[model samples]
Target chain A: MSSAALVELRDVVVGYGELPILTGVDLRIDTGEIVSVIGGSGSGKSTLLRAMVGLLEPAAGAVCLFGQDLYATRPRSRGRLLSRVGVLFQSDALFSSMSVLDNVMFPGRKLTDLPDAVIQELALIELARLGVADLAERMPQEISGGQAKRVALARANVLAPELVFCDEPTSSLDPINAAVLGREFTRLRDDQGSTVILVTHDMEMVRTLSDRTVVLAAGGICAVGTPATLERSEDLDVQALFHGEPTRESQESKRA
Target chain B: MDVRLDAIRPRSLLHELEIHARTRPAVLRLDLSALRQIDSTGVATLRAVTRRLRRSGVAVELHGATPEVMRVLAETPEPDPPKHPPEPGVLESLGRSCFAWWSGLLTLADMVIEAMQGAAGAVVGRRTFAWRDVVEQLELMGADALPIAATMSFLLGLVLDFQTWVQMHYYGTESVVLEFVGIGMARGFAPFIVAILLASRTAPAIAAQLSTMEMRQENDVLRVMGISPVRHLVVPRLFAITLVTPALSLIATASGILGGLLVTVWLDPHWMAAFETMLREMTLGDLWLGTVKSVLFGWVIGLASAFTGLHSGYGALSIGIAATRAAVASILFVMIVDSIVTTLWTMAQ
Candidate 1:
């Protein structure tokens, strides 16, 4: 265990109401690492991401960010810690009323001292990088799912924040665009030295790009290794999941 | 391009910085000796401007600052706006405004046409009408709202009767209060009460439901299934409100008149005389006119809220915002339509 973990969740128990989803979940994500969390459908992957990001509180144990207990700290301190992080939700949760330009420019406006001109320039550059600059004036509802995802990415990265959590960032994008986004995430880690956490089942992304791959099953992390190591594991469940082979969960879901 | 002879100590430094950017100054130096007082905002703005200039391929150096100013400058950077957001060009802004207005008008027009068609189809027994949903909405918005409407109208009648009786008492002609309350209740008060109450309550309910559905993409799912949301979802609410508003108005009139009667009998032993006077003056025409106005009010509220919900942006916050807009727009339009209808009917009468 490195003493310099950016985010560490120890024996975390998380759930919705009474239905426990992820129990005793322990994980450590280090600085400047692009860590991908992979799971079967309904394996509490998003819940883990949500808990780690402080959007959902753990039912038990400690979740720390940047060495401070995120939920236990005073609100001001928590906010100060959170301001360094960016998130791209699975829903592409853009403000519906704002134009794409304003949506992308929002974080810089709210979180930084950068002048409007500078922020706009940054936001435009980000949008152009993601190939959504032409859609800047359109509302979120007017854009396609893939375009919205790109716009969300631009918004998330506009400030070049120190930490980022992306949920299904390229699910809707085509192969080329997903590849572009994968490279962008790499640049985020390499250029800005930002920690990138991706909650995805995009195997190509996991295999080719991520520094580490964490597989979630039952209620907690089942395996944590390099993608290749996980793929070659003796664990039958890991192999079944990697090859999309039917397991008990899949069989149950099919019946359901 | 090494333009480094700047000793400007002017307060309007940002303007000077922008001017320097255009000239492509390689190095810029600021003499801050005249800067006596500097707040955190000023410090952040200075940094932001310098950072911007540096990003644009310029080097900015600050010199001649007192320790106090230097302390402020070294403080942690916070958010501060040095300039308003760059505006869209005039033509682009104008184009957006025009398009927005046109879209709003189009949404309203779309709602009105669909509402009318739904109502007509339901009346004509067309299979396209969502009669089942209409019944459910009526139960939800109409029956559930009866007690509040009736109680509110009862209070209005009590207040009106008491105030009028006090004023009329001075002239020894307080009996006119009975007839006045009766005519007022039948002609305007009941309809106004029912319409306003529903506008405040049911309009927002409709807006929230529809907006949430839209946000969750449930409306889109309906569209994908080859069902029009307007026909299947909105028409039911429209029919229910249109019918329910008039019925509630009529019920409210009775409740109000009953309240006035209670006040009349309490104040005077010859309550029969007052009751007869009220009955004589309460014409059916006044009742019908009030009901007609209520129908229109129902349409205004239903359509405004429906239009707002359909056009609402995605997300829970936008759903809440849409509901608020629905409540305000429905109430405002209801009042405006009330005044116009009242004036036109008075002229005809």
Candidate 2:
């Protein structure tokens, strides 16, 4: 990863059919940075992720990947660009018919001309890194919800994409599992030098994993700062989401 | 404290057995009347309790269980479910493609034979399948299809009526316009033409949409959510098409009749009398036969369109091709089936 910015969305406006979801949103991801995007549900968080990967084209703005205009490229070439951007969808979008191993290998097979044995070997290696190697043979139905999330993470990392985008990755996971994912996400940035864009409501995850955080509310950026800066900032909406959600101390005291 | 009869047998054998141990300290006198109905499930429940208690080095004694319950425990055993987890062998996975799959090869050998055998099962089974998805698709395909098909068919009738009168007027046979309209628009041409129109306009559209959704793994999403794609996706379209095709065909028939009436009534005042006379001259079988053809046409249109949609490949371009091929295939199938039925019905007379 060079010092250059990996992805840049300049004055981006995106829409679905006639309805505009994102309006003139400007954002950038530099190489090897962990940036967490926090927003309320349906606030164009997922839409921004889609636009970054060129899945949803920005209607009136430009999305440039590694300094190349996404729209100028042919659709096939754009897919090549997208292949380098790994996405972990909000729903853990795993293929139900394929086993854990097969799902991981799907992207690798698409992005590389490696032999079957090589692909399988690489897939298993990634699964092991995600701590889901034992679940390679298990069907998606057989795995627990947390286990399925890990498998999806393994699949997203299969191609070793330079930019990884996660949508509410820790939402449904238990504390232990969520912590494990947060640690791994930090390691991805520190070890592989990969830039990560995490869209989540989990405030603790934002504090622990992200170096920089952007708060989105009512469909626009509310604030931008480090975790400490955010905690001390006099932003009511940000403070409400961060501390307003029942903290562990409150929950345990309530139990008592 | 006494154990209730209802507590002896529970919906979940495991939960019931575990809950029983919880109440053991409180319930000194337990009613075990429900234990008599304890078959394998009940014995297993007891065995689970015994195993847990034994592991904890606790000795448990039960007095209320009858001799019949003791006998059932001695005889009843739990058998593990068969180890048939769907591990589609490496060979089977490799055989998943059309060029490589055994079923695909067989499908190629006798297309008609396979279709006939598969049709009844697929149609009936898919009637309840993907029903929600099919309903969603009907809104997309059938409801939308009506406007385009009706517009084309209506214009087609008008064109045919105008063109026919121009040629027949050269022979001074303007009064015979109803004779041409009744036979031309009712007997074979009306149903066949309407079927062809729907096949072209709607069938391919269904195929393309399904193929695109398939590419997006929308079908997989439904499957993961434990939704039956056929029940949720196919049935509604099948039902909708079954419903809409006839209404559309009737519209086409009405348009053709009205077009013919306009041409003849304007050209000559004797057109109504000629049409009534022609109605008497033509056999009632012609009218009945046309209605029968319409039903067959509806079935063919609905079935072929849905089948093509369901089997479409996982690419945007492939969806377009599937839609086109579906239309072509449906048109051909409808014509062939209609031709065969016509020949058979006419020969039986």
Candidate 3:
């Protein structure tokens, strides 16, 4: 891949209230790379994603997308920049009243000047790609959890954004569906040349999809390398994450 | 060579740059003195063009950029603004509130139009209306409310008759008691009381139902599906209320007249003469005016309840708050409509 950084986080410090989640963190992601951010609960994996997506402002430092500081831009300009980015929320966050097809079509209808027929055709194509075109007319509530996730993925990727952020995409899926989603992510990168940042706990997913893995611990990046390298990481926290071992701090806290 | 740039809109600037780069000058200097504003897109376009040109072994330099353009290009991060905006001054707040109320009213009016169109479509057999939903709401807002409405109207009539009888007895005008009760129950008490009862009872129920839908994001689903929630969820309830409320009011009027008759008969053995006098004094105009007012009251209550419910915030607590607001707003609207209708009818008389 070319040495072009699609996303750059320079000493980004993000927190809620006074409690810091991410402190002085630096990272760069190149175009067409699938990066996985893996950590235990409350390690601020989601917080980092939110900060990168402009949903939450960092307490300090900068998150630059395509060489422009995201939060430094005017609100309107920020919104326009955000159109080139797609996010798959943990909850799926599908509009419950709309049918699956309509949910997939929603972003395109809002952001593009495409005609209704063309938009519909595109939405159907996405649904067919995800193998859920038969469930297109089904309401979000009517679909199974896995189906909902797939539908949400289709919706997020429908805009064909340059970057896609997937938050726990495989957390609630069955093994078969999880495998399907992993393949889909790989397909997204290969076909669309889109960079993906996946936040997940499923180590199997990390092994299957991520070109690189970032291990977050103690409000900072503990290690970042390929999944194979991370599997062999010497850092105790990184080892604890990969091997499911309790680090000294966590064990001490448990005793306390 | 200097190339001047003007009106560098972010949306189109990238495309414009590609067209400019087609000439492939060995040395390109962009003069931005004419640029009044530069957005994030404009900045991004410049960066992309610079990178692309650098790869192609062409020299590029930006010159004559104004301070504003320079600031954006520098990507100097500003301190984040306060999370919550500063509170507006009192007058400004008032103006904002008035504008919000006016905007809300316009939205409600628009929803009402959409609902009416949907209802009309149902009537003309062009669209399918949820007959089952309308029936369910009718049972809830109309049939279930009958007992309380009847009891309240009966007590109201008894009190009116007793109070009027005592005063008339002092003047030896006790014979007018039946006429006074009949005219008062038909013209004012029955429709007004029934409307207030429904506003308190049915409005909250509808509001809670819709607010729960909102909380669950069901309303959002409808919006995403390109279906109007007002037309789908609200029109049925509005129609049911509009059709059933007048019937309930008529029942209230009958129960009230019966209660007054019972009181008059108990007070005097020769109550038949008073009954005949009341019949002679009662007019169709009075009955029709009360019916019209009841209909208007029903429409106002339904509209108010649905409006508050559909706009409710997320969660169970928000649903409860929305229900309370809907009830209070519905009652207030009913009273206002009642007052205006009564005044207009009185003036016509």
Candidate 4:
């Protein structure tokens, strides 16, 4: 991984009204690395990601994306900064009014000067990679939840953004498509040097694909290291987390 | 609490178990050691018996299952509890409903008030409206609505005139029907009909669209991208609907008068005499009153629809419920405000 930071959180505090879920969260994400953020449900995984992605500004401290403070900058400059980032929200926020293919092509067309044909071709390839190519012509409402998640994932990566934030990209996916997503993220990093911030509970994906995993619990990051390193750590909570979430089969595979 | 299960008996075998379990044993154990044969019906009956007992706070245990019975039990999932939890008591339910209704009203009021602030902010800040969306909404709420409003108002006028003429013709005062039709259309019927038509047609559609977008979190994406969903979505439609409602009411008023004119031309042989009588009886205040009512109804429909939509719960079912609430609340509030306005105007006079 490159030493230059793509995103930095400095003593960040964020939460809903009148209560803080994450406090004094400090971390750095570098270029060309896939970082998986794993935590139990309601453990502030999505909240931390939201603060980093410019949706919820921190109550205190700083969130620096591409070396610029996301909230402290001018609105026009913030737009320019956000244009380089892509996000797949937990709800799979595909454009309900547009066909699936149009949704995948949206960011490329809006953020870049890419030709329409090129954008369409790129969108098709991304969709095929995620096993949602056939559903491209369908509207968001017509597809199943898994299909919508795949379509949303394809759209997020279509722009080959400098930074990508995906929340539970494989939660609704079957094993086959989820594996495809793992490979797609690898391709995104190897081919485009894109940095990915994956917030998910999919331990299998973390085991296979992440360069580093950030274990969030008790209001801040408890452990941050390679998955294998964290798996064998001395801390009881970290070992229990790695052991608890994955299946018995994954545990056997890890031993082997 | 070990209850022996020997064989599959027919009627009331499970019934006896259900009745026996009514004493609410802390634990009921079924020992299947002596069971030889069991069919699908027997398994289903046993499942239902276990389910009812469990629901009533009994702990059911199956033991001593032979290999065959074990295989049968493995294939079938343990009976699940009811999907919906039990309802609260009557008073509790009523209290819950009242609290929910009041809370929902408060939330809706906050959203609409914030939107009004945004609308005012846009004008003061000199921001440009999304003209394309505004034009499309204007076409939908005003121009496309024109024919329906005209036809409905015209038919209403025709019925009123014909009914009045039947009695007035005998008194040789048939022209007096024109006075009633003219004043009624300009002051009351035209505005009320147009308000109802737009409320039923456009308000629900707006709520559905906004709620769908909300469920999908599309606005959150826009917010993340440094754009306001209000600027991109809400203000444009509000601008158009607010501009169109009064204009459509004016057109509806003219169409209703024309319908009365058709009746006059068809009945008495002299068209000029009856037309002159209707014109002389009409006042500009009547037209202005209808316009004012249309303006009030327009804002009520727009704000109420937006309120339900922005506060809609997540998912398809909730979106549908919000749209229905939009139509009903808009119409109810329109009449309440109309009555208030009319009564105030009458008292002032």
Candidate 5:
């Protein structure tokens, strides 16, 4: 991997209203690294991803992508830069009114100057690649949850973005599909040289596909290291996260 | 060695930095002493340029910065100019309202064309048009609306006859009440009353349904698939409302005339023969005008309702707000269109 950082978050504090969900988070991700950010519910895993993707602006600090501050740039320039980044929402966020084939073709049609035939062919190839070519004709409503996830994956990678943010991509999938998605993530990093930031609770995904694991606790990164290294973390919060135990703070809150 | 950094503002700071970075000086010294104010964009530009220059093996140094500029540079970019939403002046608000109204009219025209195309497509064996959905909407907007519309029309006719009958009877022109009731009920009252009722009834229902779909992200799904929700959803409902409302208006006209006939029988026991003769004198042109008005009113209700629903903001509260807005807008549009049509028709006669 190159020494240049693809993404850097410097003391980012994100929130809605007054209560900050992520506070003073500083992290740097190198190009072509698959980093899994794991946290319990409301630990701001998705918030971190949203901030990095420019969907949410941080209350303080900065998010720099390719040395350009993502939120600081003008909207038009930021939009242009965002074309190089892909985001897979937790809900899949598939356009409900369109066929799966058209859903996959959406980003390509928006971002590229390709002919309709070429766009369609590329979309078909992506669907085929994800083993969902046969379901392309079906509407998003017609497809199963797992099929929708695959279609969403196809759409995200259709542009062959340099960076991809996947939010709980494997959360609703079956074990088989989850495993396939894990492999797809590896393939994306290996073949396309895409830097991936996956926000998920699925530790098996982290163990299999991630080059590094970031554990978020109390609105900040509690630990960041290899999955195996994080498993042996001395911090109680970090240990509790990996072990799936309720942290002392959570227990106290629960009792109160 | 000295690199002069120019005025740093949010607008063009990033572009300026990119231009500066391309020169690739061996030793870059940024003179920021002249910088009066710097936003977050400016700070980000400086950091990015510094990083880019460092990568190219150029030495970067900041020579002089005003304390204010230095402080801005130290902190995360000035919290992006506290995004004060512009409070539009009266003229600005009027201009915006005019633009919105014009845009709405254009959208309604487009929706009508799309609906016609869908109807034509269905007729020509293209299943892309949703005939089943149209039928469903027809049942909801037309069949389900029959009872309340009929009752309202009947009550309107009875009230009109009762109010005017005593005056006509005193003038010994009781027979003129038949022509008054017939023309008024057929050309004016029935269609107008039915339209207002539907505006309150069907328009809100359509808006609520569509707003729910929007909140649920179903509309977003359609957008992502490159499918126009207006074409898919609005077209069917528009067609159904347009085709069914005239039929309902015809029913209302009959019910209203019957209400007048019943009132005449009650007021004067021997006036049934005179009422029938006067009713038979009613013109076909009057009935046609009512039908035309009802159809136009239906179009207004459907277009306004669907437009408000499709553009609704997120949340359950927004759905109710959208429905209310749709009803209000539809009624307003119907009144405007009705006045214009009535004026034109009267002028031509």
Candidate 6:
């Protein structure tokens, strides 16, 4: 209910075609907060992030960004709205045809009217921040999956967006790369005061990086608490999910 | 239905417009049967200048809101809207398909037009063309094909002559062997037969190569690297076939005539006299026509085969299908094009 809420989704319902996926979801993200949404596949974590970014229209409810309704605006104005919210796709989605530097420059090229030299400089700075500046001129195909992920992150953050959405950013990366990206996400939120909404099921990431956590189950918010509190939830479903425990009836049946 | 009004820009008009717009939008409509007389100014303002509006907050249906509104909205030209096309119907769905049965038939007709244009382009592009691929294609398609062409031409001539001589010896017309072979090789037979062989053999081979490269995304890679696949791949084969086909035809002709000469020498006592007499009767125009046909056939086969390969889809099955179709279509097109050119040339004469 705070007026300072950077993004607020009120009773949102999202779906593809006629198949209802996420139903009546409500969430709020404030500036400089790193919020992680954790769930297994088919839980609609990614869909919620896309809906927040104005990429998908909610079937119901309002997606408000600083009190402005995102989907209600025209596409050009919506794109201008998107300039304030950077999104890293699950697949990285870097233009495989372009070099790493050019990939990093993509958002800036789309969002800003900066000159060529400034764009190049910003691209280099972003790549350097992500510690992959040396691979600037190499095509996406030439890089490892982890490097590609970081390059995508670098691209996402280059516009200095007020909010960043990362969907399964570390799914393909190694532990080392995941840890590096985790640090980068923290720095983005703490140092730069950019709100970060990471959509991932990586528990280690949720525990280590997230300032707050939202747990989705069957397309709805199952739990919203500090990661520790969610981890310690005494509710049967929460306890079973967190501990990977079988239900009592299933256990009894197996024993029989 | 209970509705909420957040805030209106002009508060004075709110009281009047609220009953009409509250349930829907700032720009709205109501069934006039449910209401008495309405204010025309309110209708005009709603129709004229509202930038944001929604009906029922669920869907965008401003179609029948107001005739004046619809007119004004129509006046607000949208060159390109965010188009989310509805799912297609049966015929529409098939029409959307690129490689459908009917589409394939259309593509066949299209290929003929493309082949003609391609042949013209190939001829023009051939002038300044320099590439290593031409030499490579020549080695693979032409030089390697020589032994087969030569062998077939020799055996065909030798068999025909031997058969004719046995029959002609009874009539003492065996001296005409020179005339028969000379006219056959020079006029049309040798070049036509050689071109068919090459079309069946080399055209498919070129198409298969280009198709594999296409399926593997190699052609796209080259394009992304600022290389024109047409220039890099097609033009080279164009030059190669143009040079090689004519040479192979000439070789086949010489080898065939030599085989005929050997038969004449073996059967007739005055073999030299027979040949010299035939030579005197034959003109260079006969040779020129055959050579021209070979060259044209070469260009056609090269271009058509390359076109098939380049246009192939991105699948393993598609590559094989494209290669096979290219071979068959190239031969068919070559024959058709040659027939048309020959008919036209004959008509002009």
Which candidate tops DockQ? Answer: 4
B171-270, model 5: which lDDT tens digit per residue? 8877768668878888978999889989999999989888888886556544433345777788888889888889899999988887877788888766
Which residue runs of candidate 3 sit more than 4 Å off their true CA positions?
A1-256, B1-85
TM-score of each: 0.49, 0.46, 0.53, 0.73, 0.53, 0.45
CA lDDT scores, all candidates in order = 0.83, 0.70, 0.84, 0.84, 0.83, 0.73
Candidate 1 local lDDT, A41-149, one digit each (tens): 8999888887776667888988898998888986557667777777787878776756999988876765667788999999999999888899989999999888888
Clashing pairs in 3: A97-B221, A97-B222, A98-B221
Better of 1 and 6 by TM-score: 1
Q: Report chain B TM per candidate.
A: 0.76, 0.57, 0.74, 0.80, 0.71, 0.63
The stretch of ten residues in a row with the least summed lDDT in candidate 2 chain B is: B220-229
- Could you tell me the lDDT of residue B232 within candidate 5? 73
Candidate 6 C-alpha lDDT tens digits along B154-222: 877777778888898899888887778877776566777778887788877878778877765445433
Report the Cα RMSD per candidate: 22.4, 21.0, 21.9, 6.3, 18.9, 21.6
Worst 10 residues of 3 chain A by lDDT: A246-255
lDDT of 3 by residue, B168-274 (tens): 88898788898898888888899999998998899988898888777755554344323567877998998899888889888898889888888899886668999
Cα distance off (Å), candidate 1, residue B273 = 0.6
> Considering only chain B, what TM-score does candidate 3 achieve?
0.74
Model 2 vs. true fold: TM:
0.46
Which regions of candidate 5 are displaced past 4 Å?
Answer: A1-89, A92-256, B1-119
- Prediction 4 TM-score vs. true: 0.73
| Model 1 segments more than 4 A misplaced | A1-256, B1-85, B88-98, B126-128
lDDT of 6 at B203: 78
Instruction: Report the lDDT tens digits of candidate 6 across residue range A79-129.
Output: 556667777777776766469998787666645678868999999998998
List, residue by residue over B267-299, the lDDT tens digit for candidate 2: 667877867865776676776677778777766
**For candidate 2, what is the DockQ?**
0.02
